[model samples]
Target: MTTLRLSVLDQTPVGEDHTPDQALRASVDLARAAEDLGYTRYWAAEHHGSPGFASSAPEILAGALLAHTSRMRIGTGGVLLPRYEPAKVAEVFGVLASLYPGRVDLGIGRAGGPARDFPRRLADLRALLGEGGAVPHAPVPPQMWLLGAGRESARLAGLVGTEFAFGHFFSPVGGREAFEDYRERFRNATGRPAGGALAVRVVTADSAGRAEELARGLLLWRARKDLGEDAPLPSYETTRRHRWTGAELARAEVHRTALVSGAPEQVHAALTALAASHGVDELIVNTLTADPADRRRSYELLADAFALPPGGPETTVAHAARVPASVPAGR
Candidate 1:
């Protein structure tokens, strides 16, 4: 048992049959669920100009989730830094930290910042979140994470003195070296010492075949999405019916290669290995199943496998077992 902490990275996916409102609501519901399941944190993503996603403004959603749940840390899987000024971002998180104290996290991703300005923005952020800024009574400041994927980003994270969350789902090869670099170069001279995590795309089910089926199909849906298709996630039946073209199948493999999917034991072993090999304190899971129930179950099963601590209000949910009748095997 690796004792690896687990967190969530929710995109608030809007399926073909569901509305954006429903997707946002589901994010809240999942955050609450994550708290109960004993996950370490629940981080919502910030995506804009995407018809398939509902989490455009993660701070607002993060605040909502923090209000809705108790104990589990809540944050943006990353607040895109390019869209807003660093001081404003600092103030917003400062207020949130004042309200929730230790339960709030202000994770940053290199969204809008060009390479040269990244360090300056981080410096400004550090100053704004310092004792001189807003929240005086904040017992502890919001946890600052440098969400990165490559060598440069990792180096910047170490230089800026923030924890790192390597984006393994994006570029595995790049992220591996980046994680190593962060661990080697990290300097925790000032505030909280730097720790690191790896975020990966994961899928699991009752059986290995079912899990692979789900993983493969979900990859295809993502591929279609990257190609600018507004198609809703295909149902299991539809996935079964659609013949896979060579090109599409190859594209699907790109996603599938990074995905960890299988039965409970297999998934557990995979995650444990990943955590150990990467030397990360946590594994932030990004689940993208087509069915809401399956997605929820994946987290539940992982929590159980790790014997993670459960928190939050609703400890028992009968609704957990119910899967909508409409869902097919698709992603």
Candidate 2:
């Protein structure tokens, strides 16, 4: 069997009563659990000024994850490179690498939304990484990654000699053709003998019925965003309050590509087929289940279905300080 590394993109809820500290604690627990479950990485996303998705401060959260787990790699699913000065980002991640050593990853993206002034954001990032800046004493100057929806990001990643991860979960062209184009362009642009490896996000579940239920929850959230309902993100309870017409459901189906839901055997078959067909190097799993327990259970089932080995012994010496709760078995 082709080896598949499991990782999580944590978008768990931080209830209104919970402070950032508590929310971060919860995320730490989740990361530790993922590590114990033999996941290769725990990547958090960057979202500024959004509700429900409480991982806005990826740098701080990444530190917490690093402190809690010894082996699993920690990364930003993406830091909006366009949002901050590249020097500031370098400093932040530089500190992260210094503290955690080889466990840090920096995935940069071009998106920062329209509300923020784009031109100024771009200029800031350039200044930070361009030249004559205090370089972080990194072994290889950090493992940089570029994330985007199209070929431009792939080209940039190649030019910069960093990994390129395409946003298949949220982008419009998150299909086989897109992956093919990225791999081809990366090979040509970099002139590297080894083909470019790509990572994509997927939402998976134990059974088709449950998968559909979970997908409806995700689809509802996306639809609401498109509708411009700008309030704190709705709870799954609130998300379920809204309903979709048949046509709307069809649209959700079309948009929800790469999400696999079926019986355990069926899900495994589907994922394996996808890996072989696309030459994907990594599959990043994003669970959108409303309940935290349900979400955790989804990951457990997926790990078992994929026949992943249990995580090796925790590297306590490498990460002796600020260890979080020990992850429960069968995480």
Candidate 3:
């Protein structure tokens, strides 16, 4: 049996009636909670022009997470490499890696620009990070990762010799093929073992009905966002206020397929099976709930179900005095 590892993928969602500042703080608190619960990693996500998300710069957010927690790796889940110069990215994460040492990850993504030259840019990035002693120095190079949802991206990651993280939460289909292609091509080209993780959205509660209820806000948010009605995630009360149109109802059902929600044991079984099918030992979970408390509870339940050992007795960053004011806030 593959020894399953659980991690977190935080989008830093702006939940109901919360400001972007609040959303970012929630992410910090959640990261500390995850570390205490023994999640292996806590990766911040990047989003642009999205009212529902506050994490536009994951590198900055990752730094804050690193300072706030003593253990658990922190990373950008990822940085869209196409938008910025490779040298600049290397400089930023190089600083992070130096500061945090072994606990930083630089997850690269191809969110924009043409795909043809992506591999070249990735190579350029590695070189800048001291891949073959080509250039700039990094005292401790952060672990490199390629985040993608398709076969081509998987193949590119393999050819470039970086760990691959499949975006099962972004694009649920074709995961098995992507994983297989990455491993085979990586082993053949680099003559080294390949590593990968699958990111999936999940919601767990004490009861199945409660889990579904907690997930309702996100479902509504997704349905509306699909129709270009982007807005902050609504509260469950607010979600109940809206009258669902036939079109919206149908759309919600489609989005529903992307989620795995239930009581603790049920969600654990589903995630274990899902990871097995994708040939990955790690599953990065992305959960969104209208209320921050509910979101925290969801992770707490999952921690118990997975039987993860606690990292230590550390309180959340909520105790402002615990974290130095000099520590920058997560963006």
Candidate 4:
């Protein structure tokens, strides 16, 4: 069996009736909770011009997360490399890596608003980090994780000799083959064994009906966004009031696969299949909901469902503190 480790990829969603600041606070609080729950890594993603998301700068949010938690890994779920300067990115992560050391990571992707020279950008980033001239802390570079969904990204990351972080949330059709191709390319081009992680969205509740209800809100929000509706995500009650149009319904149908939800058994089964299918070393989860309590509960439920190690005995510590633990630790 492939050993599976769980991590987080937060979008800092602005839930219904909440402001962006509250969303950011929830992310920080959730990071603390994630640490207490023994999640290996907690990554924040960068999303621009989205009323529902507050994480425009994952690097800064990652720094905040590092300040709040003592041990969990923090990084960008990832940074759009083509959209930013490689030198600046190097400097940003260099400062973070020096401050946080092994706990910092940089997951970069060439997608959605990008140029064609991704491999070149990666090389430039590495080169900038190695120069030791512009950055005071250039000696300590953060771990690089290339984020992508298919073979081209796999191949690019392989050529650049960085780890791959595959996002299968929006696209999972050829996940297995893409991962396989990445491994093959890594071995052939880099002549080294490389580890890869998977990213996907998951929704869970106490029962199937409740989980579906949670799904309806997120699905409807995404459906609206896809149709160029820029308004913030509405409450589930409000969403329930809107009658669906045929065009919107069509978009919703395509987005249904992006949602994974159910009771514990069903959620675990789905996650296990996803892990087994890609043979991923880590499964990074993204859960966005109208309620932070519900979101936190979902993660707690997932932690139980996966039987993930209690990083320490103090697993009961909530979002605000990191108390000492009494149980056996997980890897």
> Regarding lDDT, does 3 or 4 come out ahead?
3
Q: Please report the TM-score between candidate 4 and the true structure.
A: 0.90
lDDT of 1 by residue, 1-331 (tens): 4457888999887766678898888888888889889888888888887777888999999999989987888888889887788778877887777788677777888776575676677666666665445545244677778887788878766655667899888877677688767666564333334558999888888888888777866877877766666565666776888887776777787777788899989989998888878877689999886677778888898888878877732322111111112212111
* Model 1, runs deviating above 4 Å: 135-139, 188-194, 312-331
Once fitted onto the true fold, the runs of candidate 3 whose alpha carbons sit more than 4 angstroms away are 132-136, 312-331
TM-score of each: 0.88, 0.78, 0.91, 0.90
Model 2's TM-score against the true structure: 0.78
Cα-based RMSD of candidate 2: 8.2
lDDT on C-alpha atoms for all candidate structures: 0.76, 0.61, 0.82, 0.78
Q: Highest lDDT, which number? A: 3
True-structure Cα RMSD, model 1 = 9.4
Every candidate's CA RMSD = 9.4, 8.2, 7.3, 7.4
Backbone clashes for every candidate come to 6, 1, 0, 4
Identify the superior model by lDDT, candidate 2 or candidate 4: 4
Better of 1 and 4 by TM-score: 4
Segments in model 4 whose C-alpha atoms lie over 4 Å from true places? 112-114, 130-134, 138-140, 312-331
Instruction: Give the Å shift of residue 136 in candidate 1.
Output: 7.2
Residue pairs with backbone overlap in model 3: none
- Which stretch of 10 consecutive residues in model 1 shows the poorest summed lDDT? 316-325
Superposed Cα deviation of residue 195, candidate 1 (Å):
3.2
